[model samples]
Target: MSIQLVFLGTGSGKPTPQRNVSSMALFRDGELFLFDCGESTQIQMAKSVLRPGALKAIFLTHFHGDHVNGLPGLVGSQTLNQRHEALDIVGPRGLKRWLKCLRELNILWPGFQVRSHEVTEPGIVFEHPEFHIESVALKHRIETWGYALVERDRPGRFDLEGARALGVPHGPMYGRLQRGEAVTLEDGRTVLPQDVLGPPRAGLKIVYCTDTSPCAGAIELARNADVLVHEATYPGGDERLAHERGHSTAADAARCALEAGAKKLVLTHISQKYVRPDIFLEHARAIFPNTVIAQDFFELEVKRRDD
Candidate 1:
């Protein structure tokens, strides 16, 4: 199974003629996850192939309008469509306050069950059978966070030849053996799982760190990630301004990617000043060769390294 990522919106503070705000989606096995719901994110999703009803959870990186202004609209749309499924949302501290404000403004679905988790410490904020969600605080103007979605390692391929050689009859027992389980044969012979199983394969790791300058927490979360989605809200010439505004420049993102040893770096949260996004890509590629600027509706399939 491959993890698919779609960059819904890639603009910085406001929506420009060529780009929207900060929003992205990860889809796998029919489940969709929204990361950083900026303005018009639902509209962007509506324009895509993803089903809004399939959204399982939302992860907010910060409370900036460019990063979280679309939650109310998204939730309201889901409610109006008669979607009653529970929606889980996780974010840094102060998220509850914003949620309460939205509820007071009558923007949220009163009947829809929405669970919110406020992450204050660096730890596992959410866990699923397929992946583990971890967050770390980042250096920013406000309470911001970077996330890591670590997929679980899959079992090795089944050795049908070894199973047959061991005189193991073909049946449901093969399925059991393939799952790293020992099974007994018709002749009372016990076959170990290692006899027919190869080594477990490593899982995929995806990290997202945006809206912040170079920080150790972001580096730690992004270490060795298969794909690192980071912000490049300014050019390298504005390093001073980038640090002052708590935003990362294209060069800063590249430095982080190089330090973290990320496999691929995707520069998102683009600034409107640069008409051509290739400038950011060029700056980032100076240090991190595997870097690209993100565009709206940008889709990538996160495949296993071995593949």
Candidate 2:
């Protein structure tokens, strides 16, 4: 299966005419996972191909207004829609308290189950049968975390010719062998999956880091990732300003990707002062050739290494 990333809002701090704040939607197997619900995220979703009802989880990097101002409105809308599926919200320590405050104020009253996970310490935050997510503490102004979504390794390809040669019938027995289960033939011969399968294939890995300066956490999360979505809030010359604000320059983001051996780098969380992304792209490409500037509504497909 392929994973697609949609940049809903790429601007940092506040909305501009060309861009909104920080929000991104990751679509995998018909389910949607949101990272950072900035202001007007729902509006952006409406403009894009994303359906709010498909959203299964929301992950907050920090408590910054530009990162989470849209949570209440989004949840309220789901309540109005009478969504029945449970929703998960993951964030830093104050996440649960803030959600509770919203409930008390009637700002958010989702009829569906809302599960909140507060990241007191960074590690594996969420897990599924097919994939898992790991969180790492980032060097931001406040408590912040970077996340890595890693798909589990898939079974190897089945060798149809070998299976046929091994006296396996063209039926359920073939499927059992393909699933790594041994099958016994009518003649009392046992065939193992290893006898008719190639080596396992590695799964895709996507890392997302924002509102942080150059740090080990970002590098660790991005290690060997297929795609690293990092914040580039300032240009190369403004490194001091970027560091002071707990943000990264394009060059810093590129260096992180290079050190982490990431396959591709997507620069986002742009500052409003920049009218265009030409300089950012130039700076990052100088350090890492495989770098792209993320724009609002931009979509990227994270493909497996073999693909």
Candidate 3:
């Protein structure tokens, strides 16, 4: 599984010359999953490795302008790119109305198909052959959500030594044993799956969250995550601002990571007031040791490790 996170935009609400807004892309098995299509996300992604036509879905956490202003342009550009694949748009309330208005206003760009899903609860939203995505409702100014992508567990590796000892050659019999089946050879010898398979391996898990105050829902979504991408919209000592705006501070992000037992935490959606983003890193690191302040175009390699 090719699991990686591409930070397309890291800046918060306002756009700065150095950074854009809240946008992230999760690449897995040649498919690109977009989270929060902030303004200029398409332009930023065009310069990155992400191909617009290959986007399988767009997940919106909220309806804030900073989080979803780029939807029209992204959808329009996809149409121009001659993409015929259906796009899944999942979000909180009003998602259907927003897309409906877009289709009505931008009738010329109706070449592609879009399916809108209004997320109501916290559970698995989408599942495919590779992975399953779940949502957790967050406490924000609006009906926001945090997402967790859990990859399906793969079959255990074949045990060649065990198979050979059981008189099973490295052929179709070994394949059957690996598939958890009992195989009978021409000599009437039986081989069980346990004799030809190692221990089961865990799958990868990535958690993404933004635009919410420090809440238990966010922590629940991030529990035991391999890579956690949380919004740190403000620096330390800005608790008042964070509470007022339903945003999170650097310390808040770290607390979420610590509570969730995440292996690695990436802080993003930074406010524009601070010229030095290093300050956010310093504050976050003070609480959670394994923390990285995300930057635009920064890529993080994700791997699944047993605890």
Candidate 4:
């Protein structure tokens, strides 16, 4: 299955003429996961290919206005649209309290179930059949979390010639073998999956870290990630300001990517001070050659290493 990333809003603190606040959409197979629903996030979704009804979960990094101000409006809109699928909202501590307040204020009266998951500590927060999500505390002024979506390792390709040589008839038994299950033949012969399958293939890992300064947690979460989406709220020369403000410079983001051995680095959460992203790209590419500056509505398809 293919995984796609859509940058809904990439501006920091506030929206700019060219960029919105902080929001990103991750489309895995058919399900959609949103990160940081900043103000006007729904508007950005409307303009992009994302469907509100397809959203499975919203993973927030913090409670900053630029990171979570659009939650109520988005949930309310889902109610208006009559969505029935349960939506999971995962974030740092205080998320459940904030959701409770929204419910009391009638700001989010969703017809579907709204599951809120507050992360008191860093560990696996959400799990699915094919993948799981892990969270880690980041260095920020407020309580914040970085997330990593890791897919489960898949079985290796089935060797049809090997199966045929083993006298294994092709049918349901082929599927069973491909799924790493042993199958019993009508002749009382037992065939293990390893008999006709290659070595297990590695899975994909995507990490998202933002609204934070350079921290060990970020590097740990991003280790060997296929793609690392990190915040670059300042230019290379503004490291002092970026650190003081609990944000990261382009160089800082690149260094984290390099340290984590990330295959690709995408710099987002751009400050409004820079009208252009040339400097940010230049700074990041200096340290991490496989770095790109994210823009509003920027879309990227993360392919497997084998592909």
Per-candidate total of colliding backbone pairs: 0, 0, 0, 0
Count clashing residue pairs in model 3: 0
lDDT of 1: 0.90
What would the C-alpha RMSD of candidate 1 be, to one decimal place? 1.3
Tens-digit lDDT track of model 1 for 1-307: 7899999999999998689999999998899998899999999999888899899899999889999989888988988888878889999888888789889887674467889999989989888997889999999999999898998887787889988999999999988988888998879999988899888888999998988988899899999999999999996878998999999999999999899989999999988777887788778888999998889998999989664
> Where is model 3 more than 4 Å wrong at Cα?
none
Residue pairs whose backbone atoms clash in candidate 2 = none
Least well predicted 10-residue stretch by lDDT in candidate 3: 103-112
Off by over 4 Å in 1: none
lDDT of 4 by residue, 46-98 (tens): 99998887899999999899999998999999999989989999998898888
Distance from true position, residue 227, model 2, in Å?
A: 0.2
- The best-first sequence of candidates by TM-score reads 2, 4, 1, 3
How far out, in Å, is residue 154 in model 3?
A: 1.4
Query: Native-vs-model 4 lDDT?
Result: 0.93
Report residue 204 deviation for candidate 4 (angstroms). 0.8
Clashes of 1: 0
